[model samples]
Target: MSGENQAKGNAQSSKKANCCQLTVDEVGLLKLKLTILAVLCVILGAFLVAFQVLSFMRVENAETERMLIEQKNRNDDLTKENTKLKTGLQETERMLIEQKNRNDDLTNEITKLKNELQGGKCADGWQYFDGSCYHFSTDTKNWTESRDACVTMGGHLVIINSQQELDFLNARREMGDGRSQRDFHWIGLTDAEEEGEWRWVDNTPLTDPKLVQPKHTVLTFVSAQYNSHSTQFHWFWGINQPDNYKEWGPQDCAMIFAGKLYDETCRSLKRICETKSCMAGV
Candidate 1:
């Protein structure tokens, strides 16, 4: 009986030993499964991190694009502004040049006028057209005599159409408080043999014009003097006094108090010596 009891205890010990071994095996398997789970979690976490990084990169790229676009727009705007400023500067330069040219022209004109205004007494009359001086004598002579005198002086008896034209002939006569009126002026109009029928030596018809008409109208008269003159027929003659002003001499014709021609009577009348250039413009 003691032997059988000893064998039973041994078997029990063996069974206990086997059960501990199984427990150890089970613990090892559990540890292996936990390790696997940890590894998987690390892999998934790495994938998430990579995905987040990619997403951030995409966002950064989009922002960069937007910034690039904005920069391009700003560059375009600046370029346009620069071009506009350049164009404006060019226009300003052009205007300045034009203004300078105008100023120069005005200065030249002023100088010329100052010089012309500083001439002699008869120089003022000559300046009427060609900047010449014409002197009209207050002496009386017959028409033929006056014409011959004008020829002798390289001039001729005066004709009138406009006051400026008359200025060429009469030299802007103002009568000077009626002192010059006591003297006479030689005019181009003459009756000669006819009454009220006047003719010019130039063969131009006798016409008395008013001033400054419209497009399709008759010749107009404009007086250069300050006084208001009666709108009367003005006659003129070309200078032949060696191309000088028409002066009168008594030897040209017979003397007369009054005759067939009133306007023709060069008995101390206003006269002029004119050039063709002066006649064409006015």
Candidate 2:
């Protein structure tokens, strides 16, 4: 019985030692599993943080892109406006140049007109019209003596060229220098060289004898009336003028009295002279 009891106790002690070893191994395995799980949790958390940062970065990039597009559109609008302004400026410059040119042309035209007006002036102490010069004298002389006086003064007796000249002389007669009532002026006309034939001092024959001579057979005559409104002289001669009537003896020379032409004796009378004329500045 004592030998049996010792053997049994030894067996029981071996069993208890085996049980403790098994318990220690199980505890070490549990510790290793916990450490691995902790490491895996840390790795998962790092991945989640990285994902969130990536999403934020994407949002920032999208906002930046939108701003860039808006800036580009504004730049485009500014460029178009600049182009339009440049075109307008060019047009305005062209119009200003045209206006300046027009002003210069008008100035030149006015200057030319003034020069023409000043160039055609007549000389002093002489009346000028249609390129001719005239001089009226107060002294009295016979027709022949009057012509000689005009020749000495570098001129000739007055020659009635056109009716306009006749009107001009009539206007002078009306202005009478205090001697119009009885004053008569010797003109360059006479029928002295040939009987009933009138001629000027320059020997130009009378083409229109009605202006100076009248027939004796005519019962009535017409006289000239000056029409101020028309600036012309209309003829309605006096009754039976220039009839070469027997009472007026041997009338050869012509003279003017009160703006009327008359055949008169070559007696003393005022003389009118004419000369070749030149414009002052021409």
Across 1-282, the per-residue lDDT of candidate 2 in tens digits comes to: 999999999999999999999999999998888888888888888988988988998999989999989999989998999888989889988998898899889888988875555444434545665567777888889999999998888788888877678778767755656766467888988889996788889999866533643444333223223222122323322234444444656778887766667777888888888876766334
RMSD of 1: 13.3
Prediction-by-prediction clash tally: 34, 6
Model 2 — TM-score against the truth?
0.48
User: Relative to the true structure, how large is the alpha-carbon lDDT of every model?
Assistant: 0.53, 0.73
Best by TM-score: 2
Candidate 1 residue lDDT tens string, 1-282 = 999999999999999999999999999999999999999999999999999999999999999999999999999999999999999999999999999999999999998876655443233334344433344555546566767676666555554456465553333444342534334455554545453344566656555533211222222356444124333533222211111112542222111111111222234444444333233332
Highest lDDT: which candidate?
A: 2
Candidate 2 yields a Cα-based lDDT of 0.73
